[model samples]
Target: MTGRFAYGLRVHGLDRVTDLMPAPPGDDLPEVTIRQHTGPRPVPEPLDRWRQVRLLADGRHLAVDRRSGTATFHGPPLTPDLLAHPYLAAPAVVVNRWTGRETFHAGTFVRHGRAFAVLGSRTAGKSSLLAALAARDVPVLADDVAVVHDGGVFAGPRCIDLRQPVPGLALPGRTAREGSRTRVSLPPVATHVPLAGWIFLSWGPGPALARLPAADALGRLAAERSWPQLPSDPAVLLTLAALPAWELTRPREWGALEATCRLVESAAEAAAGQPA
Candidate 1:
């Protein structure tokens, strides 16, 4: 599988690696390929001070650098561990440090229906909610950090290394799994959910279910943008803004899982009706 494919990542707008980036020995670093592409890719930038993540734009910007280890495309086969470390550790600024280029960050899900994902701030119950859903027979997308593209999200072919298990949720017993920041599958599960709805959870006095206008939701979404401090791309901004969003004020208890699921499902169904 290593040399099976020709290209590495298709960052919608950057040049594919025409040549490899040299890594020195004793440098203990691996070889990297600077794939090149053509399109409107985000230019490389410094890591965000607050989140410690960076965004890079080659073609379709998307990379999450966690500062764990140097990322080299020239080294071993690509795995999900490298991807989740930087973002899950600190989701604030995802693409910047990761790809050193612009990449997409949004709530990606299954197309017709099979898998789903929940993303937001830390302690936003992403893992907990996923666990709950999994109990109900839903396969977990990439837990904290998801690799999204073409309106779909893929689960890393690796076990997500969630530092500690959630208080009450139980995970499946594993026979063999690799570790990174989040233990995940190296190849990742291809089962994907379509870009249904982007739900944002907030802790406040808001109702259990309150749908905010896209305009109003935009402000909060912007605030929680993976890389808020960095300049935003109009294309990306519009892409996210255009995505239907629902703000779930943190519920008093986790009992609202069904209600929450209903709300998201309804919204997704409605979005499907609108003209694309």
Candidate 2:
């Protein structure tokens, strides 16, 4: 209630304190809800912007109204990541899309004064590299979702989901019961920093970063599956057009995170020289 988390919106029921920045507060009832499911059939297509309720056979129900900034969820009794829609990127993306903002599945950090992020496949080591950067004093802006507003970026929670113990970073106060992976925590980013650079991560390419054309960056940024479904094609495309992007490859060998961090930092600096 006192601090914020995802989407920078003040949240209720998140009493346990972590270093993550709190979302902005609102005096309304929780805009999100997840609990035991009740019987409700899938909603058929209706007028534009009408509430769309999707019911799954697994006793789950999801309803959204982007125009109204409302979302409702009902899941099976034991679902651990209850606020998956919000804590994750989908719901927030929906709202952002409605508001003409673009979104991406990426992890962002601040260098000097500007912010930069890495967009890539889920297993592309975004979190691990970000962990290494944070350990070295780079402030993490958003863990998974990067909300692109104009040419800038808004950070999400400071927490990240880690598969194994991050050596240099401290993972404190376990959050959700994410299976196999442990939810990692770090101090919240105090403010949203302007995005100066970004990189696309992949497995095969060299760990070196190469500049990319706008066409390529647009296509790749839109293609990642881990990112939420694009709500408006026009808005997302516009955001992509305004940002500079590059392709960054992950090293095949072990223990290259530190080296990669240095390489990416160089890339961010190089990008800052170009017009956004």
Task: Give the alpha carbon lDDT tens digit for every residue of 1-276 in model 1.
Answer: 111111113121112211111111232111122222244444445555322313343223433333432222222332333332332223322433244322223333332353333457666666555544444444445454444345544443233344444444455533222442233222233443555556666666533556667777566656655544556655554555566667766574655666655555555456666321
Query: TM-score of model 2 relative to the true fold?
Result: 0.78
lDDT by residue (1-276, candidate 2, tens digit) is 464456534433343434345555555422432223445544634424445555444455556664454555555443434353233355565555555666777888887678887887778878788877877777888778887775678777666666666665544635464465566666756555777867788776456777888887767776752324335565657556557788887665546667788887777766667322
Q: Which model scores highest in TM-score?
A: 2
Error of 2 at 232 (Å): 2.4
Best by lDDT: 2
Clashes of 2: 12
TM for every model, in the order presented, reads 0.53, 0.78
Off by over 4 Å in 1: 1-111, 114-117, 146-170, 173-188, 191-193, 204-207, 229-231, 269-276
In angstroms, the error of model 1 at 246 is: 0.6
Q: Which ten residues in a row have the lowest lDDT in candidate 1?
A: 1-10
